[model samples]
Target: MTGDNERPAYERGTGFLLARLGSLTARSWTAFLTEHRLTQAQYTVLVALQQHGPVGQRRLAELVAMDARNIVPVLDSLAAGCLIERRPDDTDRRRRTITLTGGGNALLAAVADAAAVEQDQFLHALNATERARLNHLLRRLYDSHIPEAPQPG
Candidate 1:
């Protein structure tokens, strides 16, 4: 029980605050990606490929923190757009190595500027130092919970 000056129980929860922030950011990201004819999953895969180089489908899925089962449709959509290539592995014919296409690289470069702008707008309240601290804290939390997950560069 609390006075009228006190925040509600839900407002005091870190999870609730994080979820609210996540929803708002996700909507902005989704809208931005939709304009580029891409989804979050597709963007994530492209970034992973850019960072890690050509990798097999299962490894790509793992790198993106996505289930192997769910990655197929995302890859299919990217393949349809010719944004990515899936080639048979040299050593293992059964394994398909996924690579970001030249087109994907171009698209990522084009959108990188816009993404930075949007991110700046979203965190306009924070100064550069504060933003860095926030990111560091978030990364620590992520590493603690998902130790196996690769840290995004």
Candidate 2:
């Protein structure tokens, strides 16, 4: 990877750097979340439910960026662990909503704190202002390119 060290700066494109960054972040998150026996996708579902309240499975899938088919197993794992509950939507019989249980909230809080440590370590080279700016730029790009996920009614 450092072969570019001798090459001109222009030779290494931003896309290549971005892909490397993505892999670095994923590995860091995987290590951190492993301690909690949670995958990043599972933690994502918990955090979304903790923040957004109960939501239909389809909406939860959208929120977590998981495919509609795959979210089920994550939900099942969480449900089996008693971290979440799947309740029938009162107004919509065909739909079910997922809610974080008290245990889930507690677990989420702990996991979030641990996750923050990983984030800090990963961005340690950046000063506060630069970190904020980088986050802002990423969010802007994501928001502009990705449509908002539909929310459960």
Candidate 3:
């Protein structure tokens, strides 16, 4: 085992770096999303809908790393703006499925472009390949450390 004092500050301080990165990333995304009149949570939900097709509210919440209650207001805003529609699941009247509308898809496209620029600006020192690798590593860390809710079919 390596002694705590044997590593440089940067090497020994991954937790600090991770926390800062998370905070900075959220701030960056929020700034980018604000231009689209979206919160980071709405952008996240839009992305999830684009990727997953229609999904239950809980499933969508999990996709966006939010609690079910927290996702409701975002969904309501989207619904009111005609960006998304919520309907009862065919199999269960009590379960609602969330889907992106055509408007949502168009909005997401615009937001995605902004997201790319924001990501590039945030990680300007990293090349495309390095960015990909960093995403892979972060996903691996998340998979190992955070237990996800089982996705519904």
Candidate 4:
């Protein structure tokens, strides 16, 4: 535990490195989202709704990997902001489906573009090819680790 040139064990760990990277990016992203009146959870919900179209609350929770009960608050906030609306499912009168409002789509489009720019700035140390390769590898690993439902195109 006493070497002038040796790095610590945590510093050498992949998980630790990922966590450090997440922390660095999260701070900036959180602030940026706050300026747009969004939290990460709320933004995720809006993005999922945009991608999947209208879905029931339970299904939306599954898509976002969040507990159905826990997502209620996020949904409520979005509804309060008029970013989304819950409507009675046509097929099933018992359940409500969530749909993104036009305002939500507009906000998502603007924020998504800016977010991409922010992400590029964060990964500026990596060249374009390197960034692409890294993203591919990360997506591969994530896909293998998380059993994902096929998303609709």
Ranking by TM-score: 4, 1, 2, 3
For residues 39-127, write the lDDT of model 4, one tens digit per residue. 99999999999998999999999889899999999999999999999999999988889999999999999998998998888888899
lDDT of 3 at 127: 89
The residue-by-residue lDDT of candidate 3 on 93-150, one tens digit each, is 9999999999999998887787777777878888889989999999999999999867
| Residues 1-153, model 1: lDDT tens digits | 456459888877899989999999989999999999988899999999999999999999989889999999999999999999999999999999999999999999988989999999999989999999999999899889976755546
Per-candidate count of clashing residue pairs (backbone under 3 Å): 0, 0, 0, 0
Give TM per candidate: 0.81, 0.79, 0.74, 0.82
Q: For candidate 2, lDDT tens digit of each residue in 92-128?
A: 9889989999999999889878878878888888999
Where in model 2 is the C-alpha error above 4 Å?
1-12, 65-67, 92-95, 150-153
Runs with alpha carbons beyond 4 Å of true place in candidate 1: 1-15, 150-153
Q: What lDDT is obtained when candidate 4 is compared to the true structure?
A: 0.92
**Over 4 Å off, model 4:** 1-15, 149-153
Candidate whose TM-score is highest: 4
Which of candidates 2 and 4 reaches a greater lDDT?
4
**What's model 2's overall lDDT?**
0.88
lDDT of 4 at 149: 79
